[model samples]
Target: MKLTVCSSVLLLLLTFSFCHGGNIFVFPAEGSHWINMDILLQALHSRGHNITILRSTRSWYIKANASYYNALSMPVEKSIDETFITNLMKAGVQFVLGTTPWLSSINILTKMVDIITYLHSAVCELVSAVLDDAALMKTLEDTKFDLVLSDPCWGGGVILAKYMKLPLVYYVRWQIGEDAHFGIAPSPLSYIPVTGSGFTDRMTFLQRVKNMILYLVTYIQNDVISGRLYQPTCAKYLGPDCDFNQIKTDADIWLMRTDFVFDYPRPTMPNVVYIGGFQCKPAKPLPEHLEEFVQSSGEHGVVIMPMGTFVSELPDDMANGIAAALAKLPQKVIWRYKGKRPASVGNNTLVVDWMPQNDLLGHPKIKLFVAHGGTNGVHEAIYHGVPVAGLPMYFDQYDNLLRLQERGGAKIVSISTVDKDDSFLEAMQEVLTDPSYRENMQRLSRLHRDQPVEPMDKALFWIEFVMRHKGAAHLKAQSYNMSWFTYHSVDVVLFLTAAVLLVLLTSFMFIRCLFRALCKRKVKRE
Candidate 1:
């Protein structure tokens, strides 16, 4: 009787959840970006929501068939894959390896631009395919999704949401090659450093000058590319006057993948909800082999290098040098690498193709993290309170690691000098031996966990909040539709300046006339 009663209760609960569930449409980017998106989709599915993901026929990471969500593919000629990543890594490596200033700057000119330029061009192709498909558009419209959830890293989703006329929510940290905040918020360049500048919030006069120049570079880049690449798509599908940047900022909610614990304090908007470490959860038990390996360390703890999935292998020489360095450590090392075995690798180290990164990081025996400084990795480190010895590969890695270093939870080693000298080894030793690094990271972990609601729950609440209301227009800023002249109050400034100048000129003319009249009266009297 009790068993039947429990079963009936479970069925009723499931029915209730299903009845209240929403239907969501998701447009996601590939690579590590998809990983977190997938996590959120899983949670939404568990809550009994129906999810449909839009993808490219050429997508390498995004799966067509998944239990959590249904997928709709847009056929396209070009796609992003490991080849792009390998080439990008090569260019980035060359850029860092360049000894001469001209050589380094040339890499910046040639391949540095290739990173975003190529990615966006491919994205534009997919966007074109999706819009050109009238049948697909009809199907999407008929479905009548509650909202469009997207990663604005690729601008295609933003354009799609505009076309569908649905509420838009962003699972975002970046937009194109720059941080998304610059597109929406009031960022004072004097203190708020631009993305990829590798500078902190506090800056000297010279640094601020550098900051302004970089900000202009980003502005020019955004304008040139939007006009050249995305404007045509918008003109065709989203109407002639529909500005792409305006559509980007018009997003109803920004589920920002950062919080104050992991990021420096800065200006924010009412619609931007910070959900840093939302992907993180308490550790689960490790696989038997991994647990046994971890236990073998005994009195000494383990050091894990949890590099994200981009790197399959490293150059043999560089690998050997890293292995040699690790060989000297007293602690055991578990490296996640798919490359050929290095000759100098120590007996203390175990390298594998994959790892339960969060599970291992949360282990009591795990002491240090050798990281590549991806956003997910950084957040996981903070969540698990593991000190990092960062090997920043490329893109925003340096900037991400620098934030933690400023907080005294991590130390960065130059990738260029890592293989050449003892820098990598020394960095590892410092983070491992110094208690301050661990203590600081633990403190951050406590602060992150002390919040009333979990970041992930907060993210879900806001997403549902949009769905319930049809949109969050009240929270959105009106600046998106404002022209540059109007948004910055440039016209108002010009008018004010003109008024001040007019008043000063009038006073000057009156004084000159009075003086001249006084002189004439004096002469006549004489």
Candidate 2:
């Protein structure tokens, strides 16, 4: 009887342990972005998986926006905190890593179990943009990642993955190179042409060419720099004999969070999966005050003017221009102004510090969106079938707005042009009253929302897929080895032809010398 009782108790304990799945650790560079990851964690937890987030000891936002003079007040990046380890123990994270830039103490966790690092942004700046700190490179080497997932930020991670002999997957969070974007002109490259303040025009032909040249140079530079960064790191960790490029393509997948509908580009490889809208979820209802405000707008609907988080302060002239434009519009306008509101507030105008964004866009009375063309904002606008008037600031916003325009759902106005009352009014009029824009947005919305799976679920599915397959190598890009000139085989063929020409030229020169000598000998004999 005692033996049977002991056996029963042991079986119960085993069942209890199995019920709680192993740990998953997350490190986020941006605090606000934690929400999206949190959603993913919640879903996993509901499925009986335990997870924990290891936030930066300090905040990325604070570093990004703090006054220059006060910058010294910012906390220096430190070794991993003990709190992170404590949380790891509680959550049972058998696997760990987050958006690259792992904390220095990450090695402590890696010593405990395997690590999976997710690259959200391509480290494009690491090559020529930022100082290549050797000590940082050594730290990356010490992590000994089992798998690396890359997003568009394309720098250090790509190279690290190569050197580490770890599986790599390049995943794009937004549409890469599309032929013609909706709101802007098209480019062959996946990203938009980056424009700086030095440019005289909004976009110049020379600027485009420069951008194209930079694109290729960046790709080559990325590979070379990545190779340099990782080769040494891998040698230190995994020994000197690591086959840096031997990481299989199947082991690395180029997963894009874009659907075929958003980008009409044909898939070149099975590994390059166009899974757009992977993070989208059904938007919930707005707060009572917000809902009432939308209901008050009546049939014409409300125009949502949100410039996004990066640029909350609008110039006085720009604010005045927007207010002037809103006054003329028949629809009620809810402007999410971060700074002071304009003195010329119209009867239909409503200014708030921060509005519930997703909820506001999802409101039935919210017809048109005035955005700064951020990707997240664009995605939210598309998910809600709302047409946008984009004043793209910089980065992917230019390209994102272009795609939205290409879909016929959005319009772009230069801040310089719309900084005046007349232009802002004209642009707002076009977006708000135009039936074509509405139709286009609705059409695209159907495509984005009609996906078989929700974005969060798909993200979790891919995350789990990586865990299950030990690394989805099939999706990695093959262009890693195929250098621009080599990939096209132009340099190799050209080199061979050059060699042949050189050989022919040398033989001709030798014959000429021999012929001259023979003529001289004959003359001497005579």
Per-residue accuracy of model 1 over 260-336 as CA lDDT, tens digit each = 99887889999999999999998999999999999999888999987635344456777788888988999999988
445-505: candidate 2 lDDT, tens digit per residue? 8878776777656665666666557676465445544534775689889999999999999
Q: List residue ranges in candidate 1 displaced over 4 A.
A: 1-19, 99-109, 308-313
- The lDDT per prediction is 0.87, 0.55
Please give the lDDT score at residue 273 for candidate 1. Answer: 95
Model 1 alpha-carbon miss at residue 81, Å: 2.3
Q: Which portions of model 2 miss their true places by more than 4 Å?
A: 1-22, 25-27, 31-38, 52-54, 60-75, 78-171, 174-211, 214-251, 264-268, 474-478, 481-485, 495-526
Please report the candidate that would top TM-score against the real structure: 1
